[model samples]
Target: MNKTYDVVIIGGGLLGCTSAYYLCKNTDLNVALIERGMLGMQTSSLAASLVTRGRATRPLIDLCVETFEAVSELEDLLGDKLDFNHVGSMHVAQSVESATAIAKQTEMLRQMGDHPVELTIDQAREKAPWLSIDQADYIVFNPKDGFIDPYRLCAAYMQGAKASGNLDVYQSTEVLELVKDGAKVTTIKTDQGDFVADQIVVAAGPWINTLLQPLGSGAAMAPVRSHYWITATDPLYPVTSPVVILPEAKAYARPEVGGLLFGLRDQVSKWAHPTDLPNSLQGFSFDEDYEGWTALEEAVEPFLEVCPSIGKVDIHHYISGPSGYTPDGKHVIGKAPHLSNVFLASGCCGAGVAISGGVGQSIHDLVTGQTPRIDLTDFAPDRFGDFDPYDEAFLTQCAASRSQKKAG
Candidate 1:
């Protein structure tokens, strides 16, 4: 007889571990977190880990704010240090149009009860003396924004959930299929064996499509690869440099341990899914083709002009990984429409690490038949309209438009 669990969570990235942590903490359910490979070794560990609270939409903004608050106190909750640096963050606008957008964002934030301060270019430069403010017209500063160690945060959740003695975490175990009887999932078939469960939560990140494809849900989840660059630590670089974003360029950077991590939003064509376990330390060969490298350098030029020392810095490394994205660019976080007992928490785009805690909490509420802490109608699995050819074309165009604006 296969061992049965009250709940079996698929994908042990930040989303999965977080869900496990919350379920164990708040419920009496027997939980098992299954990972295809090492825990948090996939997209979660490879994430840029910058935590922020601003977005193009209201639902995401609200979720991000809530998650930022939870992550700020994560160490206290876990009784362990997560190395969360409250260095604050700023979004710089290089043009009048972008500056106007920043102003609108500031107003929206204010309406949301957030304290987003609008700063002139001079004020921004004063706050961060290393920044070049010549071309920048305006900036939006949020003091509560910062970065965290994704690995440490994942470990903290796993450790705490394990200590609860109600959770079983199985790393390197691949879930092969979701066994369902009628509308309820009854068992999770894995490469090693099978485990029965009353409820299944899929927070598989980029690998979500692969797992869901077998169940004919792949079209709803697609993976996009994004890359980031790192620089050797410099004495002149402030450790408190805010998580800076050049919205016009779609580039962002933040201070990290002994160095600075940065990345642009240029995405190449999608590649086939990896068959092996995910590795975070794998380095990309930018030497083969300099398109992405050139783009990153160009985007960083404005900031580098403000700090000449930054241009002289050597490239420490290149980090690349897949981020799950929906056709609509919103997360799919409620129940799978065709399957009642299976819940989805995937397709977080690039914001999973920032909002994993809140996503987990919301999933837990759904499992217990309670209203989610945040409104999830916008992220529902069934919100994509009909999957017809016309709808697909429209979605593709919208996604392209959004990507162009984001990568500009």
Candidate 2:
């Protein structure tokens, strides 16, 4: 007989793990997490794991603050340390125009009750002597932003969910198809076998399209390649420093265990599946392309000017991964319009890690036919008007155009 579960969640990343944890701990549902490969080995592990509470909008700022608070105490709840470093974050603006924008953003943060300390070029240099403050006109520092070990956090959630005895996690299990009875998902067909479920949550990240295309829910999503680099550390460059973002340069860097990790947004963004995720783990012959590194180098040039010593830092290889994005910058979270028992949690862009906790709680509430903790009307999958395969090309073009203007 096929195994029966009250809820079957696809994708074992942070979203899936948190959903399982919340459902198993708070509800009476029997849950199972299905992953195509090892848990947290995909985009979840590749995430920069940045937690920031500063945003231009009120709702997004609230969400970030809520998530940061939740993740800060995760270790206390799980009885294991999450290895999060609350080094805060600094946003540096290169030009006068960018400085004005930063000033506006700082005001927005203040309105959101987060008073980010403004830093002059000299003050920023004093704080991080390795940065090139001469290239930047202004900097806004937020003390609440920080980074976390994404793999450890995912593992913690998985372990906690498993300990509840109400959850079963199937790693290396790929969902082949969704068996639907009219407008409801009745079973999930996987490589191992089939499992009947009362509810299904699709949080498959980049692979979400493949799983949902057949459902014909008029939902659209796009995947973009993102790359980051790590620099060898020295005693002078301590990990206590905050994560830094150079908005004018279209790059960001954060302090890691042994060094500083950085990445940039490039012009040539591709949209295709390489049959495997890009990285060392999959034994894929991947190397950092010229355009990506060039962007990173240009973005951090000002920082290096203020902190000239960092220019001599050893390079720690580059990383490239895909981020599933929606037309708008917000995530798509809600029940499928055509299927009553089917739910989706994709289109996160790069914000998935920060919002997974709240997303999990929202998914749990949605599955139980209760009101979500937040007003998710703006993130509904049905918001996309008439989606089609060719729509991806248009969406990708639009995203590329927007990025180009942003970088220009």
**Local distance difference test scores for all models:** 0.72, 0.71
* Residue 289, model 1, lDDT: 43
Per-residue C-alpha lDDT of model 2 across residues 1-408, encoded as one tens digit per residue: 798998999999887887787677678788989998888888888887787766545555555565665565566677776766877788887788777866776788887687699888777756555576556677788887788788887887787677665888898898998878888888899999999998898888777766676776634556666667777877655778787777665666777776878766665555544234432234332344543466555445644554566578777767766776666666678887687888888766677777777777788789888987677877788886667633656457525632442210
Per-residue alpha-carbon lDDT of model 1 for 1-408, expressed as tens digits? 687898999988888988887788789899999987888877788888888876766777777776665564566666776777878888888889878777776777788888988788878766666566567777789887888888888888787677664998888888888767776777788988999888889887766655655564433544555567878987545687788887766667777665667776653323223233243324533234433566565456644655565677877777766666566667788887667788888767777878777787888899989989888888888786534212344435434433554411
Candidate 1 Cα outliers beyond 4 Å, as residue runs: 267-310, 386-402, 405-408
Clashes of 1: 1
What lDDT score is found at residue 115 in candidate 2?
A: 66
Worst 10 residues of 1 by lDDT: 268-277
